[model samples]
Target: MQNKSIGLFLVILILLSACVPTKNIEELAVVTARGVDITEDNQVETMLNIIRFDPEADSLFTSNTGIGNTIKGAREEAADRTSYNLVEGQINLELYGKEAAEQGIFRFINGLIHDSQVSDTMKLAVSNVSAKEIFNIENPNMPAVGEHLDRLIEIEVKNNSFPPATIQDFTRVKTTIGEDPLLPLIGLVDEKPTIIGMAVFQDDRYVVDISLDEGFLMNLFLNKVENKSVEMTLPLQPFEKYKINTIGIESKSLEGEEFHINFLTTHGKSNTKVESLEQLKFKTDTYIEINLTEMSHPISIKHEKAANLLEKEIEKKLKKQYEELFKKVQEANADVFGFGKLYRSKTKDGKITEEEWREKLPYITVDFNVDVKLMHTGTIQ
Candidate 1:
């Protein structure tokens, strides 16, 4: 009799478990992406990109705009327009308009970071235009804008096309010296979100735009690249280019005074491509040297010799451009290159804050010792 009773109970429990509650995923307002922009009236405008589901047709996305004095207020307004409560759990990406970010992202990013429901790793970007404008973009090659963006970031980081900048990285760059925060600078191209550069920040304010090539170089400075394809124009051959596909940065070390730097890329590739590889090696070395020496810079580069600092006019014009570039960023007081952090490490005091570092930044001089080596020109396989 007891066995019969237990069996009956077990059957009832199984039946109850089998019956799923009415949970309509389609009715839930899922926020896939968010855009923050500033209106002409100087009010904060929050835009939510929600995926609307349909039972009879393909689910489509829609946008809702809310204007208010604060991000929360604006978001609440947007939520009221929909029957379902807006959820942040599905937000894959968050974008701030150029003007909004320039005003300072600290205000907007703070609340989002504190929300437990929000993914701390969601991809963030600075849009070239108003963040809301990006919603009109669509690319069938990558269906679902939010998922496509998430994939773009995942693939690029995997392929080493750009540095890995997540919530952790973004916050770290903001607080840490010898570093500045950067976000992917994205704009739509033919209805697709395209990465044009890396958005540079000094503290929390948007400072400048680092182009794709410059972004790669900055990643190299940050030692972020691994197994990246390197394509260089053969100098002597002209127009002909060679590729070091699957190149990896073994290690990068920055050492020296605040005024000078010793940037090195070590543990280079170690295989060979052809017989009698000396010529190839020499050519590779020369190419790397010329590339570094001819870098188009913003600031000037000069080494002190015999107690005197002198500029050589005969230096490659391209190298001069790099000097100008560095100088511009330096003068702007944005430590995007992490020189301030390097200075702190090499100091005797053992402590220097970002504020103090910035105060002393304008007076500091800087030079580069950029080097690239070919450990082996060929693959083992």
Candidate 2:
């Protein structure tokens, strides 16, 4: 009787195994990139670029749009006409239209966070125009739209022109009281998808756009990205020369409200010919002073006794830029530099509220003391 029971159990187990559901790769539509926007009728609009695996083709992708009262509805509508079931597991990037981002993207963000299939590693950005427009851009150099964007962002991250961000990074930054989030701002330039600026967020909503030049400076201050090579071109005067040089920026400290940087320890090779270390320093100093003043930012710096007037002036320019950035943040009520973290460190609770920071921001005055270290001064070989 025991032998009969064992055999019966084995038969039942084999029968039950066939009941488990299975999905083959061909039955699922893998989304490569997703875009969110607000329609003219004020409905939620969703766009997806789907990847098609065709063995003979160089490119494999098609895009479609869906609209509904809510994101879930729109997504379902988009999948209804497709032969395969929609899948979000392969998404590499998420884009938001300016209108959608400005209106507050917390809902969309929360939806993604709650979804089990969608990953947090996917890159997120703000589109300068409609997300649909960016998705529709055509370029022959890329294998597909999705691959083109993937390579584009990868290059920017390597160059430090844009910092790499994942959905997980966005969540942490926005939830923190003293720090805000920044996303890459992309726009179509000459019909090509180009990185134009950074989208600065106050809390969960996009508030401002930082230009490419300003964004580079901001990254240098935060030391947020690794740059393989950083090039700065300035028209040097007072010594009558123009110089294009690469700069090595190392953020010295986590200064509260204002950025404090040390350039003295950082130096890079330049293509411009210079007589000596002194001549290079002189050229860089003049360029810094002229550019900072032209931007209407005044600066002050503390220097070593051995530092010359030119060195001090160059440091002052960095200070000026730092102050200008702080002033802009205060004006926008966004703490992109994690200043709130610094403030909370002093408090007993080690906590900060976004509203409280906004209230206290206007009264905060931060002064920067800058210095520079000149190294690797020579014309690029």
Return the top candidate by TM-score: 2
Model 2 pairs whose backbones collide: 263-372, 263-373, 264-372, 264-373, 265-373
Model 2 has an lDDT value of: 0.66
The residue-by-residue lDDT of candidate 2 on 191-309, one tens digit each, is 88888888999988999888765666666555533323333322123211111223585423222332222222232221112123212111111122111112111122223322243
- Per-model TM-score, in order, reads 0.69, 0.75
Across 1-381, the per-residue lDDT of candidate 1 in tens digits comes to 999999999999999986876547877778887788999888889777787675654657667878887888898888888787677788888888999988888888788787888888888888888887775565555545556667777777666556776777788788887568778888888777878788888888888887776665556555445555533222222111211223485432222211211222232221112212122110111112211222211122222231011112212322444456567777778877666665666567758887887887676554443334323312221
Whole-model lDDT per candidate: 0.63, 0.66
lDDT: worst 10-residue window of model 2: 289-298
Best by lDDT: 2
Stretch of 10 with least lDDT, candidate 1: 278-287
